[model samples]
Target: MPKKFEEFKLNRQILNAVEEAGFTEATPIQEKAIGPVLSGQDLFGIAQTGTGKTAAYVLPMLMKLKYAQGENPRALILVPTRELALQIEEQVRLFSTYTDLRTVVIFGGIGPKTQKEQIAKGLDILVATPGRFLDLYLTGDINTRSLQFLVLDEADKMMDMGFIGSIHRILEVVPRKRQNLLFSATMSDLVHKIAGDFLKNPLTIEVAAQATPAQTVTQKMYAVPNFKTKINLLAHLLKDDEFKRLIIFCKTKTVADNINNFIARRFGEDAVRVIHANKGQNTRINSINSFKEGNVRILVATDVASRGIDVSEVSHVINFDVPIVTEDYVHRIGRTGRAFNEGIAITFYNEAERYYIDKIEKLIRQKIDEEEIPQSIFIEETPFDERQAIAREIDAQKRKENPDFKGAFHEKKKQYTSPTKKNNKKSYPSKNKKRR
Candidate 1:
């Protein structure tokens, strides 16, 4: 029998909030994680994404943190993306609705003035991205000396986002004796290295097999030759009314923006939304809020939008481009098929992407069914020449309208590398010079 939330010896106010929020049984992660966390021990939890890990950390943190003071946050959660930060904050809010556990979500991409004001007012729990948190700390806007719990949520994703330095910065300030929790969907050597660095004889819990797809999701793959053909297949899938709600993942923000523009022009603007790291915080929040409430049917986004998306009823997840990393494939499809709900995932692969298919399959330990294209696509589809012409025209228009759009993390990294005194290009440190 699974442990139930009501069985825990928690404050009446928190129990009331949990009951009001419609939670009864604890998830597998929560069942295992909550006990150790509540015992005031460090933890290293390695479960795949979409496994209710947020609740695992929050519930116990809330229970043990009932001594919750008014202003400075007692617990701190560091995540990689703004979306994940917001999602975690929202989960904490849901369970602590009736309690006095004040929570705040913090990230970059917006002015810190508002966030500084919120932090000054006091928070019991602070969810933040490392970059923004470091910035705020450096500016003396927030203090971490009172923090009792520190959580590094999605630590692998944070490393992938090049935040190891920021993590080090935060580690310097947080109390070393505090309860530490490190959570990651995949347990590779790199993740394990960080976990070992932070945890001391901590309890480790894993709910699902690492890198495996959720049991409720059915995955399919389509092999195509070129980008143009992939675009045609995407258009065909989008037109199908069977897909009530869909999320299309692109490898690059440019692709997401282009796809969003195309969908917006073909369908109603209200029917499609696009988000990425470059988008303002309000735009990202609004896009997700609209998509959650059924106001928008399709959202084109990059991996930045993939984390901490909590919509339970998303009908379909389409990978417009295959994720190069095996771990990302797990996180990408995790956007759907949550909480025992069934979902469909479709991916487009080409010869260059065949390597990715092998990696993803090996990680998930399952063979993805090869999907047969709809006959209607062949029947009504225009000639290849005409389609290519139209596609090129659309591509040209997008280029003209949105010139110099950033592609992916790597692309943006290259574009923004500081110029050297010798050349107007990224500078590299001399090996002779000391790094420290």
Candidate 2:
């Protein structure tokens, strides 16, 4: 049995807010992490998304910070993407409803004028992406001298986005006596390196194994032959009512757009929306809102939206493409099975994607249950170009495993080239040779 939130000895106001937010029992992460955070100790948390990790840190931080204070923020939370920053800010507001703690979130993709103005006003908590935070700090709009708490949410993602330099810069400017908190779903080498530099004798808490998917989420995989066949399978599956409020994750912007168009044509346009890096900030937010509000049944998106979305009761999460980043498979599936709700996670993999599937299984420490293609759906033949691409990818994977192992593609290339062809060609004089 899990512990209750009241056991944490939180203030009545915060308890009320937590109750209003529909949380009564503390999750494993919250139960373990809140105490250390309240004790003013550095913490390193290894937990997946939808594990109540946000509230785990936020609640304790709010309890410590109490009410709003000076003009400069006392607590700074850094995230990787704008979506995640906004999501964290929303969580802060939701948990701080009973208190007067002012919070603001800033990111790129728009003008910084509004963000600067918000910073000018008094705020207790500031959530921001690394780039925008650095931009504001460089312009002298941010004051880190008053910071009492610093959090690196989704530390792995930030490191993946190459924010280590900015993080170091921020560390240099901030007061050295503050508490540090780092949270990540998966602990990569980069995350480990950052932890060495960031935390000081921190308490490490792990609710689950690194990169492990929630047990509440039932996992399934389909051995798809080609993209078109995958589309057919998707169409067949979406016809069922059980796929309510699902996210279809693609590998690229082009695939996301294609899936969105196909779904729109099959279903109504209002039933689906798509988001990727190319989409504007407002557009992305609106699309995500529509999905969260149950107005959009399907959200076609790339990996950018994987760790950022925080919707509850999502019935399913479909991996339209196998994530090349194996750890991302955990994050993508994490969109569902939130708040202890039972959900389904389905993945589609082509011949080339099987390699990634193996890696994902190793990372998650379990094999995904494979399902056969439905008889109602037609499996299209692999196109010649696509077949060649898959072959090349397989060759690349082989070379990655064993550099000396050249596959059939290499042999085919060798077969096409003539050894005497080079001798038949006219040779040009070297630049160093003097011409007469």
CA lDDT, every model vs. true structure: 0.82, 0.91
Candidate 2 residue-wise lDDT, 1-436, digit = tens? 8999988969999999999999999999999999989998999999999999999999999999998888999999999999899899999999999999999999999999999999998799999998999899999999988999999999988888889999999899999999999999999999999999999999999999988999899999999877888998999999999888999999999999999999999998999999999999999999999988989999999999999999997999999999998888999999999999999999999878999999999999998999988877876766555665776799899999999987856765564233344432322111121112
What local lDDT does model 1 show for residue 375? Answer: 50
Q: Could you tell me the TM-score of candidate 2?
A: 0.94
Q: Name the weakest run of 10 consecutive residues (lDDT summed) in model 1.
A: 426-435
Which runs in model 1 stand beyond 4 Å of their true positions?
Answer: 378-436
- The pairs that clash in candidate 2 are none
- Name the top lDDT candidate: 2
RMSD of 2: 8.5
Per the 3 Å backbone cut-off, how many clashing residue pairs does candidate 2 have? Answer: 0
Question: Could you tell me every candidate's TM-score relative to the true structure?
Answer: 0.85, 0.94
